[model samples]
Target chain A: MEKKKIRNDIILAVCVLAASLIALAVFLCVRARGSYAVVLIDGKETARYSLSENAEIEIKSENGVNTLKIENGKASVISASCPDGICTAHRAVRYGGEVIVCLPNKLVIRIDSASNGGVDAVS
Target chain B: MKTKNIAFIGLLCSVSLILAYIEALLPPIYAAAPGIKLGLANIMSVFALYKYGAKEAATVCLIRISLSALLFGNPWSLAYSAAGAVLSLAVMILLKLSGKFSPVGVSIAGGVCHNLGQILLAMMVLKTIGLGLYMAVLAITGTIAGVLVGFCASLMLKYLKKV
Candidate 1:
């Protein structure tokens, strides 16, 4: 390998490591929150619920087919009959900076607040 | 190139389009982030990058994305795919010119660029800067996916060189 290749490899390694660290920190923070509010489309807020340490709560819409879970301040589609099921892969979104959206159902779960907002600036 | 070469490229484009469609069918492996794709179509782009150079690679990618969008994507998805394809091509070209990174590195960079472009487009369309927070995680995931895809391409190239 050329000297330049070695240097580039070093740079790439550093970039990857830095990115991993930042992601880990964000994941940790997202996993730390306790209570979360599940906001419905009609502007009605569900009762603020406390998240058991590492516990996941399932949110089911009237449609029943669209069910999601919120755990550790992260929201994800746990189950959905949507053809693609892309929402389910979104998994648990713990960071306030993240969002879980189901376009077909017009559902969006996002962490929004001053504390959650702080996570975005860390990147 | 001759007509035969053009036909070959056409075949590659068709293969890429089919791969894109298949990828569309693959259930998203995650649940929190909808619309995220593993970018299986990138395999063809990597093949073209190694065999035909940057311009051809770009053309193949463009044709694949456009055709895939028309066939299976929504308007918003079309926009995101376009942004991602363009950014990925640009990164691939830059890496090709630098001549320092391997094809694997170039592909990894392409993946990172693709995600960055997609995230940027998403933020714009949603009119929310809040989405920027996901950039870190997206970048990390993109890099990993890119490396995996790149490794696959490298293996394919190694086999091709023997023939």
Candidate 2:
């Protein structure tokens, strides 16, 4: 019984570790610092701004209000009237593929580099 | 349904909802990741599945998601949580039926599936494949959270029998 229990433990440990390793690899692959910020309201592109040009944007969406601030080549939600305020809680982001989503407001702020092409026909 | 079953299921639903509320109170450990949650409420889902069977588990999950959404979240969050719950529950049921794993294994599987479901929804809503770039991070977090949740459920199963 003890041996069988050990086997179960080993099997589970291996599976979880293997999956995590793969995930870590993928996580590294899709992340890089970017030079622009894109905002989407209700799944539609509403605005785009350069990371180099520091500015604050106030977005009035269907659900509520959010204020996105870009400064020091980093973008963040400085304030939001949404109940959760999760987007505001997110740290200043300067990485490509990093996203801040205000689920309550149906708002998304995505970061991408200005040096490379990112927005595609599907977007 | 019998009166006793209704009361029992209701009690489980309330407990899960309370867990959800408590989870919301906790701060996110990672500033970059918002959706990573302990999913402590899933303890009851696993219990319901093991004790009263899949149908009871499904009922408990459905009520818990709906009530918790009404109490704490907006329409968008409601939609996201509902989709995640459904996919997670379906995966859990399949794992349970396979009979190859324990409650701990089932909960882990459920947790991972839940993250995938939510990620897929987020990608679609954002209209960007870049959203998937962070999925690996979520997968790692989900696995850790899954082990914690699964551990709790296994312990609870040892004591609690019926939903």
TM-score of chain A of each: 0.47, 0.80
Per-residue lDDT of candidate 2, residues A22-65 (tens digit)? 76677568656777888877767778899998899898977789
Regions of model 2 farther than 4 Å from truth: A1-17, A26-31, A61-64, A118-123, B1-7, B28-30, B161-163
The DockQ figures for the candidates are 0.26, 0.37
Best by DockQ: 2
Q: lDDT of model 1 at residue A65?
A: 55
| Residue A35 alpha-carbon offset, candidate 1, angstroms | 5.7
**True-structure RMSD for candidate 2:** 3.1
The 10-residue segment with the lowest total lDDT in model 1 chain A: A41-50
lDDT (Cα, 0-100) at B26 in candidate 2: 84
Candidate 1 CAPRI category? acceptable
Summarize candidate 1's per-residue lDDT along B16-125 as a digit string, tens digits: 89989998787664533334467777977987888778888988999998888899986657777899889889988888777898667777788878988887776654
